[model samples]
Target: MVANQNSVVVVMIPLPLQGHLNQLLHLSRIISAHNVPVHFVCTTAHGRQVRLRLQGWNPNAVSTIFFHDLPIPPFACPPPNPNSTNKFPSHLQPLCEAATHLRDPVTSLLRKLSPTTKRLVIIHDSLMSTVVQDFISLPNAESYTFHSVSAFSTALYTSKKVGEQIRELIESKGVTEYDLSFDGCFTSDFKEFMSVQHEYAKLSSGRIYNTCRVIERPILELLETDARSRNKLLWALGPFNPLELKRKDDGPIQRCLNWLDKQASNSVIFVSFGTTTSFSLEQITEIAIGLEKSDQKFVWVVREADKGDVFNGNIIHVELPKGFEERVKDQGFVLREWAPQLDILVHPAVCGFMSHCGWNSCVESMSMGVPIAAWPMHSDQPNNAFLVTNILKIGILVKDWCRREEVVMSAAVENAVRTLMGTNEGEEMRERAVSLGQEIRKYVLGNGVTQTEVGSFIAHITR
Candidate 1:
């Protein structure tokens, strides 16, 4: 079934998020390396960001990856009345508008390519499933859905029993264990968004997950066995991360690297949530206090949040405990802007990660052999935290979604930090993490599982 490689094109449409874009970009790189052409569809704003980021990439290698910008549509939702309990609409409005507006332009792009292209395969974000129907309607165009979350998270969402279990967990107060039919493990406005994504998944030709077989075998196997999901082809083709890209040592990256050089091996905890996560002023103060109380060497990345943003509408000015900076001046560094996350994880000084447990961060930390202090924020992060702490045993939970509405006390944060960085159990977890990291590296290199799956996908699209 080997078709002419030069005649085929992969149309990659990622959701307008940093994590999703990063995974798809890396996947496109792998496909392009096989000499296959890639047409990456993104919004103008995201396209500009991508183009700027690629300035550091190998020009000749990425030459085949073309960008197609679908302008974000102007759509507005009425502001929440002062008394309305719903906050999800304001957070979701932008993405909803983007999804609805991008479909027509994406369809037009596919239509133009169909006449000359031998085969057109559209790989879209799972959330952007609305576009799949449009592409599949076009002549010679095939559509596949890609999830940026773990296989475990995917399985939980797709499985009826697991979904029910999660519902019960959400309803019951003080419920700690997520006892499911299998052993794996949101709001109404968030619920509606997920519902649309679930419906869209059913219409796709197949699905691709950014997780590996070895890491999530049980959940993946469950997905394979489920009657509802059994018919769809599931490809586990990841730790799809940009491991090879070297970070330029200038500004914050240089400062962080220099700071790391002074610390003892595996002594510092690297703290950061992914791009979209934001914290309340109370939460920030608590975290700062916790870190100070832990008395550990650390590097924490903090970002200012817009108060108007519905999802994470925290105050912009984060006031730490008075004299907090002076107290821990020798022991910590708080980065106000972006820090080189991947570079920091691989440093010898970083022993643990305080993370939101986003899939990208989770995979990156695991791949780098750095253990995590799981503090899940939203979306699939709660499930990811469960996987890291309970299933993978590579991390400990600092906070769970069940208590997301409540502010985490500094004592709780301090306890989690100490347990992750100082305790005997933490040592065991670190050892396991190092071993898993090595295994993941071997699995993604030449002729490994990830490569084989990517090859298989290329064959599927070409044939």
Candidate 2:
């Protein structure tokens, strides 16, 4: 296609992580809809994997989209001491390396595409701000970093996760990094994230968040009302949601979805922790046991902790209480190592969600109008749990003492699930979630006033 309008080149620093990938993917569609001849940038190998998947997906070339290939990363040996728990507590560093290396190559590639390729939107995740800062120019060729978290959740994250780190980095960088016990200081990740974010807000042409302003009205207004930050921050982009799907194995998945469809309306509880977050062998067992004790119909989807099938394991017997599956199997207690989540949540039978309350999952659950049992695991999840339980009034929080990150025992899990699955409480939660879901749909549809204003963000930057 010839350049009928000013061209926009969207650069996505693709992580092996799922939520980040899904956010960038949603941006690709949005950029395309805006009439920009958008090109997606991904790692050489991941790019190949995407191509292979898409070939299987669009055998008929139904969708008109293209991905730009960048240099392949060299294979590196495994970390000297690999503790899955502490492993890559800073995955952001490598992504920073990726953006630094990929930027020039991407700019050169985009310019070659057309004379009207006036700007570049780099959908860099919050953790990878170092990569974004290196980008030389903004107004002519701009970059927009997408916070995969809501601004409020981001606020919470900054308060706890990010700020704690900044304090550590300031107070005792050596102590915080080296001493395992000293490293246990819990503050706010979202605060330090905002430090990087405010910096990014200044340098970039515009700020893009993967949240609808409606849900986080105060946070959105706070960002907008600031004399320091005005149109620079943009929201109301989309549902920006994701699902697990495989084209080659679509048949079996479709069958599972079909079975879910046949079940009672709002009867199933969905449980997933997403791809990047891992549950230890111990954690998985407790979750299984908890769900069993809850005595509710469930469709639990646990991503493999390591490389292999979990079904052959004691997922039912060892993971859950003995004979639990046998008892509930008749009630349609479907268990899977993975699931087509977006499909499952959107399914009519899905009454509630039992989630790690990762930001994307939080938004998706809310978007689908499915009330949630917020079992927040690591990172910004606890803050999102707070948002869901307190701010939204759309769902209930399954908290454990003062310990938000504690592995929820079977009793709490049972009670929480029972609450969501039971009569009066469950009905009320479903009603609230549905009402909020409709409000969020406006951002995804670009029909809301706040969202439509986002399109002018580029213009605001130039002026």
Which numbered prediction scores highest in TM-score against the true structure?
A: 1
Candidate 1 stretches with Cα past 4 Å from truth are 1-5, 50-61, 75-92, 161-176, 179-185, 227-230, 305-317
lDDT of 2 at 62: 21
List model 1 lDDT by residue over 129-174, tens digit each.
Answer: 8765676576677778898898777767667765554445444644
Q: In lDDT terms, which candidate is top?
A: 1
Tell me the tens digit of each residue's lDDT in model 2 across 1-463.
4546454655665543456666666666655555455566765655554443231134124243577767745433221121244322343334334444565665566456434555555666665555456556444456666677667655434335433443354344233321112122232453354365456545654456767666776566555544234445555465665322233335436666766867888788887766444555566667777777776778876554321211123432224446656876755455454455667788788889988777778878888889988865555666677568766766777763246345657777788888888969778878999988877775555456434654664344333
> After best superposition, candidate 1 residue 113: deviation in angstroms?
1.1
Question: How does each model score on lDDT?
Answer: 0.74, 0.58
What is candidate 1's local distance difference test score?
A: 0.74
Q: Which residue ranges in model 2 land beyond 4 Å of their true spot?
A: 1-7, 48-64, 75-100, 110-116, 132-134, 137-139, 156-202, 227-231, 242-249, 305-327, 332-337, 401-405, 442-446, 449-451, 457-463
